[model samples]
Target: MLTERWRETLVDTYGTPPIGLVSGQGATLTDEKGNSYIDLLAGIAVNALGYGNEHVAQAVYHQAQNLVHTSNLFATQPVLDAGAKLIERVGDVNARVFFCNSGAEANEAAFKLARLTGRRRILAAKHGFHGRTMGSLALTGQPDKQNAFRPLPGGVEFYPFGDADYLRQLVELNPEDTAAIIFEPIQGETGVIPAPDGFMQKVNDLCEEYGILLIVDEVQTGVGRTGTFFAHEIEGVRPDVITMAKGLGAGVPIGATITRGRARDLFTPGTHGTTFGGNPVACAAANVVLDTVDAEFLAEVTRKGDYLRQKLENLPNVDHVRGRGLMLGVVLNAPVAKQAVRGGLEKGLILNAPKENVLRLTPPLIISQHELDTALNTLRTILEELA
Candidate 1:
């Protein structure tokens, strides 16, 4: 079996595979046994347009045929197009991009940029998830993840998320020397926790007053997953830097760090680079994602999310639903979220449990109404059975 094969051959970081996905179409995935399931997690929010996206397939094919890699020395049209698309969505006239291989790499780039500010301290939100690399891991506020990798890159501080007063106190300790504050607009990994209203505006003011770079980690919430091109756009604050990955390449491996104004100019030549950072194939897919998840598409995501949230609110075991767009966390009346995931799997639905009581649903942004209804019906059965 694929699970046994993985246990024999692969590292244990993710443990054994629960299911082996051979192919996918629309929001449905087929396992090794040819059993199909409605894919709700979307590879943990990576697949924006869902499976069998024709435009991405064609773009990737075309680019792969002509060119795939140019290292950091040369450039390809697809990579250039990808960069342009990111800036177009970022809406920052002076924004510059550094492409990498994953969300962690993008956060790594942001970490290095903070170091270039010549400051000793950086602040991040508690329970925020930013990649697992040494630098990004340090910026991550979770102690459980950091404890195993002792002596991580130092000088990072953690602040309670959404507590603007606590953040102000931390910054006021030595505002001039504070380099950057990295945070997620919505903490996706811990739970789909949105920043409190007006919190971002206060953070923006503090950053501006102290000349500290504002780094918004959009790794999970970017590329129209949250009904906007970027989740931070809802708060009306312009971050000096933004890191994105998950949905940008429509399931391909790609990470991007977009820097604006002064932060934009920090990465000079010989500073930071990657070999597979801007592969033409990956860029090609990104170009398609950017072109597709536009105004009309995003509007539909908003409507679909509202519908899903309302439906979940009336579900039997669901205490509440919190999130924007397709990124939702179903807080359960009981600590049966993990059981719900297993139940979903058994009943032809793919789901995730980021917390014991929180069932996270990050289905493909393009999942159809019929697909949603089917998944919800199955989920209703799952909850009732648990009850």
Candidate 2:
């Protein structure tokens, strides 16, 4: 059904959808043909409180009725309130917020901020994906994506991920030339690989020794996806800049660059801005999302993550499991991830395979135990058949 409609209307970007979803409520989606599915991807980790949540919907409605947009020239109450709440939630008084429309845009703003500090070279990790924008693309270490868009902004170097010694050597060799070191706490696109033990701390020390800004791109892992408000909190390292988007405003399009200490003042009045960056509707939705992902909700996320890991580990053909909190990866014995995803969809489950051998799971933070158990059952049946 999706193929017939998508072939005529939509572009050929994503190929074909497994099913035509009509509506969603909580962690489940309903198709046009009356089929229901357990949504484990959560719109690529964008739905913080799941679909059609009362608080988020109400916040969007009230803000829409009140004030929607006033441009960046004038200050609005909702934007200011959201910014204050972000600072408070992060527990960093010196941090400042720069709003944007998407994860790539947030990374673009952070890249500009790093450049403004009089540093030229940017150091990123291998297989790390920042964004598709020109500035952010330069920092993306994947060659397959970057080769097509040649003549991109240069002066970026890629180092082995989770290798502190190689990173230290690079920083020491180019201390004065390096501007910032940007990386993801967990490499989501590359199968949810977290930093090795003590590697993040070593990277932080290297950045300090080289006087380079450290930027953590938390677009996919932030906002309770990793059982924390911010994933970097688990490592106990405060980055100079943190870029977030996916789960910030639930389903609304919103992104932000939060800078700490002196890095917060890098941008002046005319340096960087966006027309709809801090719009009232998006900020209002983000405020609701933040309020919903409090201490108790985070505890539930940890509990669910542990349960999901144990269940997935016991499933047939699942060789290993990686990642923390609700963000997890099931490494299969063979490259049957695509087949498993297709099979799960047929069994009324929505999942994603970011890599050939790794199946990614980013269920909504509000997903109930019953819902998770249902998903687990569906996945187990599918994997058994595929194997």
Candidate 3:
């Protein structure tokens, strides 16, 4: 079986899956056993347009046929278009985009930019996840993920996720030494926790007052996942830097570390580069996703998110819902989220448990109301049985 083969050949970084998914369409997936599932995880919020997207496939196919890669030595039209589109969405003509392969790389670029400011100190949030890469891992405040890889790149200080007063105290401890303040608008890895209300505005104000750069990590919350082009946009706070991935390229791997104002000028040519970053094929796919997830499309996403949240909140075992838009976490009254995942899978649903009591739902941005209703009915049954 494929699972057996995976166990024998592959490293145990990610434990083998119980079953193999053969294919998918829209928000539904088919497993090797010929069973179908309503995909609510959406590849951890990567497939914004859902599976079997003809437009993304065609864009990738045509771009691959013409030019797949040219490294950083040459420019590609798709790369330029993707960057311009991101900047346009950011509404900052001065913002510059640095493309990379995944969310980790994006945060690494942001880390490097902070270092370039000549101040060694950086502030991050506890229980917040950025990525697993070395620099990003250091920025991530979760000790469990960092303990294994001890003695990570230092100079990062972590404050509790939504404690603005503590954050302010940390900044005042040595404001001159602080280069940047980095955080996720919504913390997804630790059960989809969001920053407290007024936090974004506070972060922006601190950065402005202290001459520090504000870096917002939107890797899991961007690309219309939060019913906004960027989650931080809702607070009307424009950070000096924003990093995003996941849904940026549909299923294609693409990460962007975007910078505005002076922060945009930090990397001068040889300072940073990626071989496969912004490849035409990936950029072309991103272009399709960007064009498809416009204002109108995102409005629909908002409506669906509210609908799903209402259903989840009313579930028998559900405690509440956290995060926002399509990037939601259903908090259960019991710590049986792992078991709930198994139940969901057995009942033709693909669910994710980021915490013992939380089920993270980041379905495709294009998932329809009918799909949501069907999935909710199944989920209700699963929760009832568990209860």
Candidate 4:
């Protein structure tokens, strides 16, 4: 009934959601049919702390009671706190944070910053998904998504993802015309494709050599999802600009476009703004999330990620595991990823297929070993059956 109601009321953009989850706790979710499923996707990696998290709920509740929203004209304590924490985590003491509502807005801000550099050309990566907004959409290289919204914002060039040589050639060819190089540390929507070894470092070096700004789109791979505060941390590259969302608020919608060094000075008074970008309620929730997912907590996530990867790698039908930490994708020998999702749902497991043969797993950062093992066992069973 709820599904029918959704179909009639909501836009068809997302298609029909297969499961109508009524409630959840920790890593387990219960649907309207009263069937419980182990949630391995974590609302597509937004629920870093898992469901029914008391800490996040309490923070949001208290902040809502105190102050819900104030237009950007005024400052809120939670917003200031959230921004400071992010800036500290990124190790960019001078960097400033621009808050928005989702990953698209975060990337949009980064796009605008890139444009302000006075260059007409921008370089991105193929199969690298930024977001759906017009500015972000132009940076995205996936044709299927771009074709529908033809004639997107211009001045964007796409290179192959994880290919340093091609990227360098493109950047060199553009030279003075290029403003910035935007890329994801790990491509999530394109099936959790991680950058090739030293690719990010190369990007950083090239940007420096060419006087171009480097924008790392960490929207899906940041916030402890990749065993670090930011996925690009592993590359040891300090990008001029970084964008993040998803797990930032642990489910309370929040996005951040952070800038370091000269990039911070790009925005003039009337250059940019957002109304509900850093609402006090969302900021409070994000603060709790940031405080909870510290070094110790992230270390545990790394351990669990390694454990899950090892288990999946041993499965008969699994070809390989890609990506890092909790953001993983299983490339199967067969194009049964959709089937696996259906099987998982029927068997009380939550799974996702970002591609025809790729099963993505972006479990909550706070997911326990026991929960991960249980999900793995169910997945192993499903793979065996499919095989």
* Alpha-carbon TM-score of each model against the true structure: 0.99, 0.98, 0.99, 0.99
Off by over 4 Å in 3: none
Model 1: ten consecutive residues of lowest lDDT: 85-94
Residue runs of model 4 more than 4 Å from their true location after superposition: none
Which 10 consecutive residues of model 4 have the lowest summed lDDT? 364-373
- Candidate 3 lDDT over 1-387, as tens digits, reads 778888999999999998888999999999888999999999999999999999999999998898889988888899999999999999988888999999999999999999999999999998889999999999999998999998999899989888888899999999999999999999999999888899999989999999999999999999999999899999999899999999999999999999997598999978998889998999999999989988899899999999899888999899899889999999999999999899988999999999999999999998978889999999999999989
CA lDDT of every candidate: 0.93, 0.90, 0.93, 0.91
Can you write out model 4's per-residue Cα lDDT over 267-305, one digit (the tens) per residue? Answer: 889899899999999999999999998889989989998
Give the CA lDDT, 0 to 100, for residue 319 in model 2.
96
Candidate 2 segments whose C-alpha is farther than 4 A from its true place = 1-3
Superposition TM-score, candidate 2 onto the true structure: 0.98
Quote the positional error of residue 30 for candidate 3 in Å: 0.4
- Count of clashing pairs, candidate 2: 0
Predicted structure 1: lDDT: 0.93
- The superposed Cα distance between candidate 4 and the true structure at residue 213, in angstroms, equals 0.6
Summarize candidate 1's per-residue lDDT along 76-176 as a digit string, tens digits. 88889889888887787689999999999999999999999999899999999998999999998889999999899988999999999999999999988
